[model samples]
Target: MSPDQFHDRMWEILQDINKNEFHAVAAKPPTDKAIANLATSTGIALPKDFLAFSQKTNALCIMAREELWPEAKLFDVGPAWTFHRGLVILGIEAEDLPEWANIQNAYESLVELYELTDVLPLLKIMGDGNHYWGVKQDGTFVEVFDGEATTLECSFIDTYATEIKELIQRQKDMCELITKRNKKQH
Candidate 1:
């Protein structure tokens, strides 16, 4: 079965088990093992090394000062599959760094690189760690002094099928570019 179908079925099963209250804290896919179990029971092969993304702590701070509190929105930036202001994250493989970097560069370039916003260097988050950055509510890039970094984390929390779909598309796009580049060199 298609992966979406597989996952939808799994959700349905969970819904059935939860008596349709899927939002209960104990019901959603809380851990990788739990998610894998659902996939397995539903006869869906888990995507290899699936990543769960969590938001950076610094970003959480900005989110806390909000007028609405924890009800922030995902940015609608180009290249983003989805946006969440509180704690945005995605899971990608270390082996996929080149493609990830290309996508990152594409995002930075699309934002006009340093002209429109300063792209802080990727940072290793410290303690309960994840990485994030703040755009001042006033439309300015959050400034970073030398040796400073934007934070990020790989903690798995909310998982979206769109992220999986978008990542698949990125590989397709990269391969097509590689083929075109290779043909030119040959």
Candidate 2:
């Protein structure tokens, strides 16, 4: 699917899951000049599809769980309302965005730390700081774990959609299990 189609589909999924409530924070789309500047500054030739995606939204952070489940321990490190399990797509630094959401920062740090020159960090799986989904100059998607990279056969957007679906399913299952246990206790 094209980048625009993927973006629309992702929003549809998120909106449906949240019941039309906004559970995500998305940065304003960056200009073409800004994208060009980023490419020049990073020295990594960003893929055309990725650039297209970025134009739609520079970055996105979704807080899938607005509240903690009953009888569940909250180990998340962020806001009180956040369950901390969601999706994050890294992009250019914006004034309103946190430092960690900057694609340039992530890319440079990973490259410097791991001595990697091929992979560019793009997507971050919330709750885990060690793993990332990135793309190569050749447009191959890769999963990076502990600084080691493994190529993924699927497209980046497809993988991203799958991750969102899995997260939603897990949340649903947890809610069901909790309800069942509560019923049994009563």
Candidate 3:
């Protein structure tokens, strides 16, 4: 799909998830200045498709759990979860953004930590802060696992669309399983 089409598809999926299952936060579109600043700060030429996406939503955070599960109380732990698992697409840093959602910060840190050359970090899968998908300076996509980078044949936009869809589906499946377990218990 074209970049614009991919953006529309992504928004549709995110909206569906937000309306039915979990909460999702999409930041406002970044301005030209913010995009330019990101490029200058990172010293990497941003991809055209990525630029198109940034224009739609500067950042996204989809919460995995909207409320605490009752099962947690059985484990003698506080009724609170320490971390959430979901998807994150880092975008240009804005005033309202959390530091973790800042693309420039993540890109620079990951590149330096991994000794990765000519790659730009973009997406964090499973909210692990370790697995990532990034664009190389050559305009190709790479998957980074535990700081190791592997080039993927698909374009950045296509990879983004596919991965996001898979993650959403996995989350839905897990939720269904939980519901089944709860029903059996009662």
Q: Which candidate is the best by lDDT?
A: 2
Off by over 4 Å in 2: 1-3, 12-16, 20-22, 69-84, 173-186
lDDT at 87, model 1:
19
Per-candidate Cα RMSD to the true structure, in Å, reads 19.4, 4.5, 4.5
Count the clashes in each prediction. 8, 0, 0
Per-model TM values vs. the true structure: 0.22, 0.76, 0.75
Per-residue alpha-carbon lDDT of candidate 2 for residues 52-170, written as tens digits (9 for 90 to 100)? 76777778876554453432356634332224366788877555657678787788778788877678888886656677898877777899988999999887767778877766665
Clashing pairs in 2: none
Query: Model 3 — TM-score against the truth?
Result: 0.75
Angstrom error of the Cα, residue 147, model 3: value is: 1.6
Badly placed stretches (over 4 Å) of model 3 are 1-3, 12-18, 68-84, 176-186
Cα TM-score of candidate 1: 0.22
**lDDT scores in order:** 0.28, 0.71, 0.70
Q: Is candidate 1 or candidate 2 better by lDDT?
A: 2
List ranges where model 1 is wrong by over 4 Å: 1-159
Candidate 2 global lDDT: 0.71
